[model samples]
Target: MIEERNPTNTWIVDDDSIYVYGLKKLISIKGINTNLSHFINGQEGINALKKANENQQLPDIILLDINMPVMDGWEFMNEFAKLKPQLGKNITVYIVTPSLDLNDIHRAKSIPEVAEYIFKPVKISQLTEIFSQTQYQTNERIRQYGT
Candidate 1:
């Protein structure tokens, strides 16, 4: 397991239990040692995000699923747009969906809030790569901007 030098909180908003289990394992192995929050659907995830924001404990990253029982990912994004400014935090959102439809991919790409669209059954290597790039970018920003 790779060790996390700079901790980050991750939120997974997916309904599939098996996928969630596998993702949790992968995240652990990839060494995201901070807290992980799970939400069954988009609505729940949104609500939790709002609550967490109120507590000043917003997650750093969110892994969102597209299809769900109530309030799909698209709907959540709509609501999130309104709530985002109020949250007072920068949260990176990744659309982690099983859907391979072109329209879905296009829609996710169109959203400025979405960092990336990832295929289902996320790979450990992908996570590592993403984290590494994110870490590098963050360091660069800090060096340039004095954060």
Candidate 2:
């Protein structure tokens, strides 16, 4: 789900065409966030972040897919963490994927950028959890500089 506390600007990323289509539809039909954006892969997602940063600010939260090609969530998180010192804002990230493997969960937890790891199929409750974390961090963006 995309970030939307009140009039939000957020994004969702996934490589699976059907998954993307379903998520976009589910998000919209469920009234998730009309202001939300979508991306096919981690590269596109990260590029969008760079562009957004240049324009105003990056997304407040990101629903990142773990197993995309070329640049997966693991790679995305690596690059995103590099921007933490320069962006000057803590952008909350949630790892959303269908992988239920213990290794995936353990690896995701190892990354400081990943606020949470949620397995698919995605649910409204999952979005609520991500929003909760986003709310907590958005309220203290300055305090999470090291994050």
TM-score on alpha carbons, each prediction = 0.85, 0.79
How many angstroms is residue 25 displaced in model 1 relative to the true structure, after the best TM-score fit? 1.0
The digit string of per-residue lDDT tens for model 2 on 38-102 reads 88888998888888888775778788998888889899999988877777445678898999899
Model 1, 18-56: lDDT tens per residue? 998988788777675556789999999999988998887
Please list all clashing residue pairs in model 1, or write none if there are none.
Answer: none
Residue runs of model 2 more than 4 Å from their true location after superposition: 1-5, 132-147
User: How big is the positional error of residue 34 in model 1, measured in Å on the Cα after superposition?
Assistant: 3.1
